[model samples]
Target: MHPATATPTHCPYCALQCGMNLAPGRGESPLAVEERADFPVNRGALCGKGRTAPALLSSRVRLTEPLIRSHATGRLEPATWEEALDTVAEGLDRNRRAHGADAVAVFGGGGLTNEKAYALGKFARVALGTSQIDYNGRFCMSSAAAAHQRAFGLDRGLPFPLADVPRTGCVILVGSNLAETMPPALRYLTELKENGGTLIVVDPRRTRTAEQADLHLAPRPGTDLALALGLLHLVVAEGRTDEEFIAGRTTGWPAARAAAMAHWPEHVERVTGIPVPKLREAVRMFCAPESAMVLTARGPEQQSKGTDTVGAWINLCLATGRAGRPLSGYGCLTGQGNGQGGREHGQKADQLPGYRKLTDPAARAHVAEVWGVDPDTLPGPGRSAYELLDALGTDTGPRALLLMGSNPVVSAPRAGHVEERLRALDFLAVADVVLSETAAMADVVLPVTQWAEETGTTTNLEGRVLLRRRALTPPPGVRSDLDVLHGLAARLGPGQGHPDLEKKFPTDPAEVFAELGRASAGGPADYAGIDYGRIAREDGVFWPCPTPGHPGTPRLFLDRFATEDGRARFVPVEHRAAGEEADAAYPLLLTTGRVVAQYQSGAQTRRVDELNAAAPGPFVEVHPRLAESLGAVEGQPLAVVSRRGRAVAPARITDTIRADTVFMPFHWPGEGRANTLTNPALDPVSRMPEFKVCAVRVETVDAAGRDTTPSTGAETADAAA
Candidate 1:
């Protein structure tokens, strides 16, 4: 490839996957980004993280060579790729010899391209013959996915494209702070308002996105399910539901409606702390419109009751006949860059290449034949991401682990404990572009190629499969993730011990994608017809694109749901308190989220000078009244302690949040690590950790480390009253 050519690509950040052109830099310089105006998703818009993405590619921050931890010195030292690969292979084989194949686990990331995700899953099953494989995406939107699958019979983040937002009559956005998390996508909501459509934002705090809403319902932390049920109750009581539509297109609505009726407005107000009048107004605004949509994000999905909470919201949509209709449906704002694709293409614990259930004999047979393996050889389903990590270093857990693209040390809930688990692993190998917090603890760290240095395909939030072309060659010693997988598979396969395993893994992305298409031929997330050529010819193609001549399905469930009966199922759900509730010892609720300037875990973005300057460090956002009671002032250090651990950050007093709640951004590690205090209570169905709400108490600290009582401000009297 020539240095001056511009390669069309997508941002390596959020699910929005804002399109951009990577212009090759002159003579050894890194690639520079240019506006990709033709791409419909973002048009020409790019966020701060997207604009400065190339900064992480600088030689100063990027790892150019493999690092091996020396036992004698207890320090990581540079080594040739050959030596590092050999060490990793030897360690993994030794662990497999002692423990079973399940004792060697693999952890994938949501940021990987679809090919890489597909290859990683195949590598775990065919190469290592291990069932213990999962990814960080389990923590992102599994709850929403489970809810979507239960309600709609399929799990595509958004049933319709972002362009429909402006045309919709009303949209109830639950728990997403698009203004900060996804700035480019915020324009869609802005356009909706400009188009005279109503926007209702539901969150515990009055976020930047909520400020622009026609109605902002600030519920208590972890009370979103109750709030949703309350709205549905109002809808049913006021006869706002589409009885005809529900009767025609949905099933099990009678039970769902009965459940909603149980949660009256007054009872919901007591549970969620939102007045009954506001609930009524919200229902009126949503139902008065001809069509409306309900969208959820991490806030409602990252709870112990996440699946049911999201189900409640979906039930609201079903009762109101908002789904499976033009311009109205249920959607999830996927968080990670490739969170949508990562789950669909086999990296998930229980999924096959095409989002097929691993337990299904037919699905297993299809993918097995595609991989040139026997169906029976494939291992059964395994634990989810958090459960896999939790089992590490334990007697029944995997003895060795191979991780790529994820930094769970700073990102996982109860992260302090996860860090301990990582430290206890007998052999840990990590492949990443930078030395992340988790990578630094690994025995062998393999340098891998990044976004512009590799060519692959990714399915965005809209289920649109887009191609990311290679713009430049990677620096010496850095290889693509596929190369690493290929080497490992070659070393671990037939030549080493198992004679049957031979040349099963492919290093080329296109070749792997071709195999993926075959594996996904008739699965739910069917991509049998999508190829790199089709992606390049057209801007992108939506999935369930089964044949070459068939146009892709842009909107799902328009004619009928994916269920066997061709009808949407409404799962009855009721409100429940959060996993951890406020008590005397910990009399406040704590929540965590992202800041505009930093990406997840802050592994790459923290290395960027501009991003670091913008969001220097983490802080606790406390309500002004809470700050007054805690004797904590703005800029003063506060120690937020939970049952799990404690994290100290400077207090940032704001009235935007509720008086009994505190918010923290989980991008930093050590003293500012919000995950340190987060609860790891898992949702029964989704296995999602309760990162949204945990019980914690905030106390002021003096410069000398002594605790001090909060001094009451004169202005706090009225606010507290």
Candidate 2:
């Protein structure tokens, strides 16, 4: 590809996968982006993060050389790629010799391309012979994934294309601020309203997306489960359920229905803080529509009861005959760029390629055959993400870790503790394009190529697998992740008693993808028919494409669910409080989320001056009543203390949030790092941490050493300021 020639590709940010044309820079300059209007998902729409993604390619901020920490000086210095790779191998081998193969672990991220995710999983089991491997997607959408698997029999972020949202009669968007997190997607909601359809927004905060809703229900934090059950209760109370649909297309509805009936309108209002009239109105609008949908994001999914909470919402959709039909179903708005694809491949702890269960003998045989390895050699399911991170440095934990593309030091719940675990590791190797907070702690850091500097494939939120073309040459000393994996495999395989590195761990993306396709053949997330050529030719191909001549499946479960009986299963569920709740000691509920200007961990976005200016640092969004009670004023520093830790940020009092709760964005590190105060209580099924809700107490700090209440009222204070 010529430097000036433009190559069509997708954004490097969220899963919307908005298409863009990457115009290579002149001479040694970075790539420039232009809208590629041909892609259906976003058309020509792009968010600020998508537009400014190229800014990260600048050489000044990007890591161009491998770094190894010096033992004597305790500082990182530039080193040859050979030295870094050898050091990593030595450390991993030392740990394996002392402990066992399980003492060496691999941690992956949802941002990695499909090829990388596939290869990383293989490298862990084949080369390192370790069953301990998982990815950050566990924290992203595991709850929604678990719920979907239980309800619809398989998990795809959205069963139908986003294009169908506009045609739906009504949509209940639960726990997502699409306007800020995914700006391009907001247009679909706009179209939904323009088509005379109703939109009900559910959240604890009245976000930008909520402002546009026909009916915005501001519930208390950690009470989304009750709210969902309450809606289903209304459906049954009003005699609005589709008895035919439930009887024919579903099973176990008797138990699920009884569970919903337990959550009456009055009890639900008391739990969720949404008025009874509003709940009734929401039920009326949702059930009245001919076709309706329920979409959930991290809000309801990142909790101690997330899977069941999401199940409650799916039950509501199933009861109303809104699922498995045109423009009607339950879906999840996956956050990360490759979150959908990341979980589909073999990176997840409990899954093989094609979303096959690791514990299944048949699944192990199929994937092992594709990899030219014995089925018995393939390791069984490992620990979940939080569990793996938590066990690090302990007697039962992995002594060495290879982390790629994840900044858990800033992104994990109770991050202060995660950071402590990372520090306790005997050996830590990180591969990334930049020196992230997590990478800064690593013993050896390898510089890897960024988005436009590599060619690979990623599945978007719509299950559309699109190829991201290499538009520019990487800066000197930096290499692609595939190259890094290949180098490590070659060095580790012969010494670690694994098979030939060349055949088992190919560096070429196409070759790896071909092997992945074979491994995925006949599986739930089957991608046997999808190829690089087909994806480029068709713009993108939806998965479950099993054969060459077969067209990809854009919508799933239209004819039948993926379950053995071809019927959706309803899991009975009830509302429960968050893992940690408000009490006398900690009187306010604290929730965390994203800001429009920054992405997760802010490793790349924070380096971009434009985005940093938009959201310089975190601030507490406290309601006026809470601020008054705490004697805190706008722009004044306030300490939010929880049992785990304390995070101090400038106060921004607003009525958008509930008086009994406070909110913070979990993008930055340091004192403003919200995850520091978050609870790590995991959801039993999904293992998702309760990032959405925790108990905390707010204390005002005096500039003049006085603990007196603020003389000015919240009415005169500017929250946005």
Candidate 3:
């Protein structure tokens, strides 16, 4: 049966936005989820998360009513949707009148579909006229996006589709563990490996991806820029660069070479811990191959020096003449399924749809005309997520905050500080499908539709765009995020916001998507050929799909760059230490990451009995020597404390990681929130905190089975706002 006539059409779990066919046979027959072949990127493969999606769609914990905390009684009560929205609208207006437009801020999520993302951006800038608006993508891809713009005058995550992977002769997998994170996308990597293509992996730990590589380089965290510079140093010093490619396709080679000379293999070996010999071998392998791809992900991009590190990696590709050609370029593997699309549709602080910068006069004029508003009326780039929270306790901070599909109290870098800020907010609203840890503390909770109940578009790690079809009606009382925002905008009056705002806001998502396409036109991420009709009729296509009859570009910079000189520019890099280093008092380094069985912050996966059973609780992996010294044994409780806060979890003895470091998953919060112990120091360029490195002390806890870590959700919700 066709999906439109079926019960559900969307994947329940991931924001990947892939399409599916749901077949229900009888009253009692279980529904089967088959991959919809028309889906662009996935084609038909489903990850473990995707396979378990349906259960999430039917979860009992989903919110289906409007909730408000009465100011008079100090109690939460169910209210009609109109009553709840009226309360929010009044509160926003009151706050705006008292504290001015900058006092209010909106925080969006990468999980929202393209249509919802564009709407959120427009609502914040046009409807509310607030400059303090940003999204969770600031934490995920800001650095990579900035790097792309700096290098190629564009911000296409991969600049090519996933189909190009199989054609590459060499693939450099840096700081990304695709084998565990997205198992279904591994076909191309596995095929390339089987066909004798060289696989080089670089990371701080021996991840599933690293262990399978022909060569694995375990550099110290945050020293990736140094390593990249060193590799380029070798490439240039030994005269192994593509001289013809460099001369014709790049600029600043001489200066970059001079900077590289200062970071020879021997110099970088001291910082990265990669031996000179091994580094040389990896460099030789990468440069010798005719077709090569360099990719980085969460690790390098989630650091204090993230953007510079990304720029250095791109510099390596430029020096080697590997980009703008089929199957070769510097690619960043995004963590969220829709991370690419979220940034593309103007959800970012400094951008408009189509990856156009907010600062670009022409781009701003185009969007302004499309929305019938003054270009100068839109706010400039805003503070990033970490900075936004930091601004909360200060006089310069935003007083009222609207959080949509994000749980910063649990997921942000500093849990204690975030909680403090949330409490201090003059007004706070949380829009989510479920009652998350952050939602529990909200003054008002809006029931928003989940993926299976919404329709729109999403782009994958590659630049490919695909449609998200609605399968079931949203649960009673729940609405799409766009609809919720529109309702609130209408109640606030002149939802278009400024004196120049158009007469009304578009209710049709297709119209909103069309505006987004036009915003991207003539920009680096042009999608002029795509529309709702085209997407529905022709599966989906990758961008820069510029015009009709024009085939979408599979790769970028085939012959030249977008730079004024028609050449890519190289930026020199230097190695920097992690924000916090191990000291005598705090003698061990702590690093955090995700477990294959769970997703970020465990808002959804933790609710599933089967998934929770696979990894029931958080465990700290320590070297046997460290565990013994602390009188801790396997499954025994221990307290790991940093200067900021502490967490107590079961101990697991493992040598898979370096002896100097302890590994923990960032999924759990409350009593054992990794964020409590994580430092909040920011990288100057990207403003991303150092989640991968910190200093901590270990001690045994006598509490036995009683884990004292705070529960981030219901309990807090009951006690707080």
> Which candidate wins on TM-score?
1
RMSD in Å for model 2: 2.8
- How good is model 2 by TM-score? 0.97
Clashes of each: 4, 0, 7
What would the per-residue lDDT of candidate 2 be over residues 383-480, giving only the tens digit for each residue? Answer: 99999999999999999999999999999999999999999999999999899999999999999998898889999998999999988888879988
- What would you estimate as the lDDT of candidate 3? 0.76
Any idea what lDDT model 2 has?
0.90
Locate the minimum summed-lDDT window of 10 residues in model 3: 712-721
Give per-residue CA lDDT, model 3, range 1-721, as digits (tens): 2234554244543434456676543332234577767565566777666666555655376788989988898766788899888888877777878888878888998888888888888888887888788877777777887787778877777776676776788888888887777666677788888877888998878888787888998876668888988998898888888888878888777877887788978779987778999999998889887889998887788787888888888888988888877778988887776888888877777788777779989989988887777899888988877888778635778888888978787778878888898888888888988788888888899988876666788776777677766666666788878778778877776543443333345656777777778777887777777876676666667788888667776677777777777778877666677788766667676778887778777787776666788888888877666665556779977777889888878888876666666778878876678888887777777677777778877777666644343321222112211
lDDT of each: 0.91, 0.90, 0.76
Candidate 1, residue 551: Cα displacement in angstroms equals 0.8
Which of candidates 1 and 3 reaches a greater TM-score? 1
